[model samples]
Target chain A: MLSENSDKIQLFKYLEGIFTELEQQKIALDKSAIVAFTDIKGNITYVNDKFCEISQYSREELLGQNHRIINSGYHEPKFFRNLWKTIARGNIWSDDIRNRAKDGSYYWVATTIVPYLDASGKPYQYVSIRFDITKQKNQELELVRRSKQLEDFCFIVSHNLRAPLSNLLLLTSMIQESDDSEEQKELIGRLVKPVHLLNETFNELVESLQIRQDTDIEKVNLSFKDCLENAMEALNVAVLYPDIEVHHDFNEVPDLKYPKKYLDSIFQNLLSNAIKYQSPKRKLQIRIKSYLREGSTWLEFADNGLGINMKVQGHKLFGLRKTFHDNPDAKGFGLFITKSQIEAVGGMIYAESTQGRGTTFFIKFNAK
Target chain B: MPNDPMKTIDTLYLIDDDDTYQFIVQRTLNSLNLVNSIKLFSNGKAAIDFLEATLHDIEQIPDVILLDLTMPIMDGWQFLEQYLRFRPRIGKKVVIFVVSSSIDPRDMQRAKSISEVTDYIIKPLTKSKLISMLHESLES
Candidate 1:
């Protein structure tokens, strides 16, 4: 109320101006932070407009709810236990927490939960001040994934490169230990084996490197049957196994918009592998089919040949220079490249097999 | 005790996919008179098959098993994992030495971590190095 005296009216206006300034500062602080207040039992008490905006919860909906309402379940139980312990002890707990919003999307928040104490020095309320850090957290996760891939790449390169080099060293050493001139000549002649392998390995590495770059994702609509026919013609499976009965059914999904090179390579590898590992005692049977499954088109190549023992070699099935049989003709580069090609086009490759029984390979292609 | 250490290891097993390694290493063993018998396998699968079948027979398992890391069918790591399961059933206290061309520290760490793996040797296992290894294991 303003007094009739001019001096009293001026003083009242001055006090009102100071209060308005303080209220403006409070609004600015609330806007900058996602603020919430919870009771000692962690029940939600008060939440600023910013908090409601970020969590997509209204004041009435969140008033009685606990912090668990927005819990993303991404963290371990021990994390929340430690956080509660610290805050319950009237201490500030600061951590990066991932919480879920009403729309089911997750966001990261760098938060500080400060406990407010009563006259008796016991925590009565906790004020959580949070700043969105989802962008930073995503960057950190991407960095970690890339570093892990780099490490795996280093491992593959080291293991594959060293195997051939070892042969070179051992081959020369063996020749050095020999005495007979004729035997020496034979041993020296055998040197071509390791040398040829080294050359093959480097060539495979170069090809795989090109695939890993994954810049050639140009696609054209192509028929599955035609690609298979082309690959079979190149491989000449009929000459290799005349009695090898082959079947194809691509009615459900006859064609794909995929990279021509990758499709041909995949077809060629699967066909040759089936023919190469054909059972010695029985006639080989091969069946190829394509169908739509789980929102993706899948190509299945099933062969009643010398099936791989998936139990033993499943993990390294797609690894570079990895073989699952004693076939001298097994170069182990085909599957590696096949997998790389499949994955490059947002697809995947896997196999199931039983030794001396049969092996089936599945290639998932994008439905588009 | 046998006066000659070479005779101590009456039989040895070499498991590797590389034919060149098998050839030269076999010759090196023969020239050095390292053992009276040497059984060879091209992959871990064959060696593991033998081990599983002969778990009850003490004479079947060789004194020294030189394992290669990279092989067809079953890799050395897969073999080691399977071996750990059947190790208690086997009668012999066989010593397994991992021989790999991989100079990667991860392989070295993996080899050292396995209780069944006695040692990890890099490729180019010379005759002299083999002889010295024979002496070390025999002495222990």
Candidate 2:
């Protein structure tokens, strides 16, 4: 009898040791992971300290709330529905989830949710474990953006660069075959225009490439008037006739911290476009204004020239190689590059126009 | 040698956005003595409008059309969709060749899938290629 009793006591001691080890493992998991428990209906029942820390919410505030409290709205409704269907059927669900913290900041988590089943094989509760994956997710997003940019670059090379180049080849071939010196001279004359166009397209490509790569280009406080004057000075001498009337108002906002080169290019392109498309019936008139609105600096350029039909051409006004007018000098690169320069710094450029009337462009700088 | 009157295309249409391409191609074809008249359009819309206006005018209708794919206002694919709708009513067999700088296999495959398109030609459209294409059109 005494030996039998001792054997039972020894078994109990071994089980106690196992139970202690399991408790230690749970504590270790709580330290390293954001762990939470929710009832079958998805109401939060319990949360670990790590969950409160990562969510940027107080334990008291998070206790009665649901996972929707931290929803980032990045996923569609179908995503959450599928997740719920899996977990409710007593299965484990795993995915990378983007969540919103209390401070409005976004975070990514690699999550696994395991359901605890009742006697009827239906889930009674779920335990979710999540690891921070924000850094990796951001890197993946950046990679996608870069690949899209590369695709656009390839398209530009094939269409824009190759178009003029093909003309050059055809022109030279025609020149070689002509026995008449007079005809040969004419074909050679045609060659000059294509060659010039090819060189210009190449330079435009290089300039745009430089703008994209110079994301961290140095910026300084610049005067609005000085930038406008520099742009005018850089323009062709023919465009600066005495009849051109210019006006400016910078009282509300005079200076802005921006890249000088980009600002100057933007001004020059807009000024030239206004001049190039001017109507013969009216004298060229340009108005420039700047103001601070809702934490952003806004600049406006309104011109009285041959305007565009907004309904027809608004969507493609900023697209590369898109031209509206039949003007011989319209290369269609100015507005495209202007947009790129503005967008690179988290700014925006848009225009409003009425056919045969005028155009007004609005630029909003990124909030400092 | 006197040129055979029947061998020459009466009216040919060149629809492309590039002015230089239009100028050079017209010049080269003019030198060939195989095309009598060449009509130029900057985009698909203008060409389609002309075709619509001249549906009954056989003299103005083109025997062959060289179409470019990329253009502002109306693209090649959009034009093809419109052309397919009105093709039967025109009552003329107008052969079309898609000439583009795009070497993309997808573009080539798409162009070939269209029954109205005779063939896809990659630019720069050379003299010998143009002659062979014209001859093929004549015989067919």
Which 10-residue span in candidate 1 chain A carries the lowest summed lDDT? Answer: A320-329
Q: What lDDT score goes with residue B80 in model 1?
A: 89
| CA displacement after TM-score superposition, residue B124 of candidate 2 (Å) | 1.5
Candidate 1 residues A59-153, lDDT tens each?
Answer: 99999898899999999999999999999998999999999999999999999999999999899999999999999999999999988866776
lDDT (0-100) at residue B75 of candidate 1? 88
Assign candidate 2 its CAPRI class: acceptable
lDDT of each: 0.83, 0.86
The whole-model C-alpha lDDT of candidate 2 against the native structure comes to: 0.86
True C-alpha contacts between chains kept, each model in order = 0.52, 0.39
Q: Where does candidate 1 stray beyond 4 Å?
A: A1-22, A53-59, A176-179, A212-223, A250-258, A272-325, A328-336, A343-368, B1-8, B48-61, B72-93, B103-107
Model 2 RMSD, rounded to 1 decimal: 4.7
Count: clashes, candidate 2: 0
Query: What is candidate 1's CA lDDT for residue A161?
Result: 63
